[model samples]
Target: MHFTSVQCVQGENFLFLVNNADDESSFTYEEKSGKGPRSWGEINPHWQACKNGTLQSPIDLLDQRVQVLSHLGRLNRDYKPAPATVKNRGHDITVMWKGEAGEIKINGTEYKLLQCHWHSPSEHTINGTRYELELHLVHKCSQGNLAVVSIVYKYGRPDRMLSKVRRQICGIDEQLFHHIKSVDPKQDKELGIVNPGDIKFGSSRKYYRYLGSLTVPPCTEGVIWTIVQKVRTVSKEQVRALREAVHDGFEANARPIQPLDGRPVYQYP
Candidate 1:
């Protein structure tokens, strides 16, 4: 199915649209395959943006190029506990909120929380240095635009939110293996009530903001990206658990850093 032709109804489940737009089994992280990231646009007509989009994401935040702007302000969020589920999507582990999980405000526009997923070795790098993990808090406004808040983690103390759902993450891997061995469809494990606030944003209110596209295929553009300035800590085991949870060939799922393309990167004070 072509993603560009998919009609998005206001307040509809954006995650559902994303999951169905492209088949996960059709492409892979391995570069040797013809269906890898570099060839995503050719694999399907709907994903031409993957190769042609000028505002692609996962760019390296070079310190020499950022413009510090205090007026950009702190990230304003009003999150709450919501019924959620954890799923191993073969490519990554995602925690999906099944109810109103609250929203984040940017430039006076409110974007409702949708879902968050993890990527190993961090998709966005700082001054060319990649971290151990990256967490993307996905949100969508009523107008169907997306705004993502990304938190990159280094190796040290365990992450608070990941620690909370460690057991569930392990179970997801087990279920995924079972499903792969059988003919049953994939399933999401109920994570009960999960509070988005538990995922800390660190002490610094500073962040780098820019416009970019989805790192995954379809590679939709115009996503508002807010990357936290502070690099938090996570245990080695935590990173290992996440990497092992996904199927093979996706263990290192971070996309190669895209060119800045002369886009201005703003840093908030």
Candidate 2:
């Protein structure tokens, strides 16, 4: 249903060009000037959802407010070790799955794994305290529905998955800046084969669920947010490597916490 123009074709590589010159999707995380989240509505009139949307994300998870629901069914995550590439998207480092590799089932709808990204200082906070990092595993169903699982990371031991990604990123001195830099492990590359399940969730499978929008622009509001309660640990060196991977002057790429605005947050046991 959706078609994109092939901008560049070289041997077997094809590049699809997306026209987002006038949208907030082109904006950065700078909070002071007109290019920030606060001015997204005025800058890009088309993506007014960024400012006016009620169900926005990166909310402060207040435990006293959530309703504990033990009857909610468990989410099925069928992720396999797949070939992936890492991209420095100006704001964050993202690991993208190559092809039809894995899928996750939520509420009976199966959403396939697309890509995973991180936010330094974390996007979601627990009771007003932010973690060292947050990893978002994004999935999409064939019907265009999105379901994101949020993993919180603290500083302690080295994380295997993160260490692998950090090793590849540590060598690159230049910033891609709106471009994707590939990491091919098969060719003895930087990134390694990472199973989605390898991401630590600690001892609890419990989480806080809510209906919310994307943290960034074009902030579509149908996204199902699954915020894990357990926190994992990663080494200080790993965190340092990730910080170095960011574009200049944009060290912290996390969006500010949004107001919950009376939305019901459920705790699934």
Candidate 3:
């Protein structure tokens, strides 16, 4: 779906949301394919921001460029358990909450938790180093503005959240393997009641904040990105399972890091 900016309730700015599921066949991570990241904007008129937008996401969080401030405050979240479903989106595995799980308050504006997804080898980097995995907790405000909370992971212990839904993911993978052409791409496996809080953010109260765009098409900009500073642990098996669950070309689903383009990256105290 095409996304366009609209005035927010505050009236000081405009924001938009990426509200539709992307057609996985239309794009891919394989650079050999003409539908790779470099050609996303050219492939669709609505995704022009993928190539031309200044404030893009998954930027390398360089220490020298980050401005630390106590005023930004700790990452505020109030997520809860809700009826959810797990889906293999061809490109990645996503856990979608069926109801209002909870909301996170940012700068006095509330963004309700919508869904969370995984990206392997991380999209965002720290000090030029990419980790084993990354989880994006996506939120949206009443105005349709988006905010994402990201937690990067290194191989160690299995993630609590992933472990809870691994079986569902594996089942989907198995079904797709046996019936690749017949399995519905939009099918979702019921996850009963899953808690977003189970996805730990480590112990670090600090996080990096910036304005960016959706890593996927239509690559809409104006998204608020919050990347937690502490890199959590996940088992190698878990990471491998996530990679294997998606389509072959999407084994490594991370988008290439985008340039910061002079946008400010803030570290909260």
Candidate 4:
């Protein structure tokens, strides 16, 4: 069973906090991942200290009436994208996944869906339990406001998107990863967007809404988080595709949850 506890604490990501904000605390950058030279979300030795430390995000689930704002009605004013493009975010890791998609509208803002990546052992740990996988739907507004739709995976069935994602990358498993010399997330297959463009949205009315940081460091806060209570199921074959992707490490892609600092996590009214 996988449970995700998300908090909507409004503010910029913590990386900005440690750098720009004046009120710094041990919560800012004392963790392991914070000290490493890793890129925005990639793993590094720094994560070890972070896992042991407390100050993290996706805090406890709080019961309250969160204001349900209308989806942004901003349309893609100008959009022309490839099926997939690789982003060398400077962490020695290149994201060769999906591309900017002209779909999924919300709150007056028409956002473009970028690449979707997988996480093993899940990212959001609810109460104290974790899940098998998590899919991050990365979206960007024309103005540059970043919004992420986080979907947790439950194994036993194959999810179509997950299956397609696995076929894109080469080595997604540990034994094969450790057993082999090297694996390239960009080589040996497709490097493009692979999710359905016409999947219906607003299919569920229940969602946990919050303002939280990126689960991974530099643990930025102030991101608008919407964890849908209703999860879509995928085929078991789909789950294998993702499970076989990383196949290395102890499924350590998820970041530690930060302290709520008295923030409110609300369910849609």
Candidate 5:
């Protein structure tokens, strides 16, 4: 669960505080960092049966049917700067933020906003070609089921909103910087930053969703995914900024796309 701010209803990391992007669950661990990402609960060693699981996430949507996902629901988002403890690839400009009360419509069920994050080289690929980055907005039902809205960024027009975040992508923090120390995600201003048609006017109403695991470590499975068919755009500089923002010296952190494995990768009409 993501807690936007610790003061939000006096947040608790393990309690799943209904709406907290800063709620510890939002933290990610990097094996390369050695100390790993921060967390509020016990982090699992790895996914089941597969010790070193490569079936994590961000697979290229190759040869799969392209279909659109019915706009389930949407929630307003705002971002603020939460600096990183350490730098990656000589970049210290990593930022983390909290999500506010946003709306989400999932299969006719309404859920509130929870949290969001960014993955370099957008995890899900289209026809085997990966994007520069991917931003995920996660929502959850009161029952704890999850729904994720993803935005894929490619090299093209530079996203102005991203420029606000450019500082972290370029800043260098030699030591570890706990995001919990200074967290805020400034959102909304980037609304039209992405092509409107891509979301509302997507050229193809195509998508592929299946039961899968988290792309990062621990690789938790059973996540109900909703991948959009339309691809979004960003600037090459944006990609470079992100690539340099982590402390792990990682040029890329996305997991390769996993197989369908007899699982019906659904396509929406």
Candidate 6:
């Protein structure tokens, strides 16, 4: 059976829709035989945005090149506990939120939390340094504008919230590997409520902001990107869980850092 999450973004959600189909060869890992990041444009001619778009994401952040701006304002995150469903999208673990979970206010605009997912070895690099993992909290405004908050993860004390999600991801992987009945998260009462704020701990108002596109295909641009300056931790076990959750023997799911192409990235201090 296939599953598709609710479409709350202008009634559009593409990731789940694309993955539910048996043929996802249009996009896979970098090391895989099918279409990867490099071949995104080839997979679909409309995906020329991935190649032709000037404001592509997953760019390397050079500290020296960042402009200091004090007017970015404080990031107001008001995430409340809400029911969530975790799904192994065959590419990565995704947590689809339910109900009025929370919202964030930045630059006088508020964006509602939609979902969060993982990317191994991170996508954005800090001064050319990559971390063990990365978490992307996707949000969108009523106007259809998107703002993504990226938090890099380093190995250290096991995060309680991450640990809980890790267990579910690993379990889901096991069920898929053994060809067991697919677990319906909606019917599982034992699943814990997810509070996005739990992962925002230790993150400060300081962050790097820029205009960029989604890291995946159709590689749509116009996303407001905010990458937290502070790095968080997930235990080594959690790292292993995420790595194993990825199907195939591929070690990483991160897209290679793209060229900035003269885009201005600012640091709010």
Specify the highest-lDDT model's number: 1
Residue 164 of candidate 5: its Cα lDDT? 35
- Model 6 spans with C-alpha error above 4 angstroms: 1-25, 31-34, 166-192
C-alpha lDDT of all candidate models, in order: 0.79, 0.68, 0.78, 0.44, 0.45, 0.71
lDDT of 5 by residue, 25-109 (tens): 3334453543233321234432231234333354556665444334422322232233222112121232222333444554555
Greater TM-score among 2 and 5 belongs to 2
Q: What is the TM-score of each candidate against the true structure?
A: 0.87, 0.81, 0.88, 0.58, 0.58, 0.83
Error of 6 at 84 (Å): 0.6
lDDT against true structure, model 4? 0.44
Order by lDDT, highest first: 1, 3, 6, 2, 5, 4
lDDT score, candidate 3, position 88? 71
Pairing residues by index, what is the TM-score of model 5?
0.58
Model 2 Cα lDDT, one tens digit per residue, 1-269: 10011111121100111111233235767766557778766676766877898888889999887888776656567888777667655556678777665987776668788888878879999888899989988877665567789988899887767755544555454433212234321222335466766777766687888877778766666677889888888776666656665562336777888888888888878
lDDT, candidate 6, at 46: 60
Off by over 4 Å in 3: 1-19, 167-184
Kindly report the root-mean-square deviation of model 1 from the true structure over all alpha carbons.
Answer: 5.4
Q: Weakest 10 consecutive residues, lDDT, candidate 1?
A: 176-185
Task: Encode model 4's per-residue lDDT on 203-234: one tens digit a residue.
Answer: 55566655665555445444556565545565
Query: Runs in model 1 with CA error above 4 Å?
Result: 1-21, 168-185
Of the pair 1 and 4, which is ahead by lDDT? Answer: 1
- Encode model 1's per-residue lDDT on 1-269: one tens digit a residue: 22222222342333454443367778778778777789988998878888998889899999998988887788999999999977777777788899999999887788899899888989999998999999999988887878889999999988888877754445454423333223212788777888999999987778998888788888887778899988999888777767776764335978889888888888998
lDDT of 6 by residue, 1-269 (tens): 00011122442433333223223435776646667778886787667877888889899989877888787766678899788877666666677787677988766678888888888889999999999889988888786667789989898987666655545444443323222123332232224577776785464667888888788877777777889988888777666666675563346888889889887888877
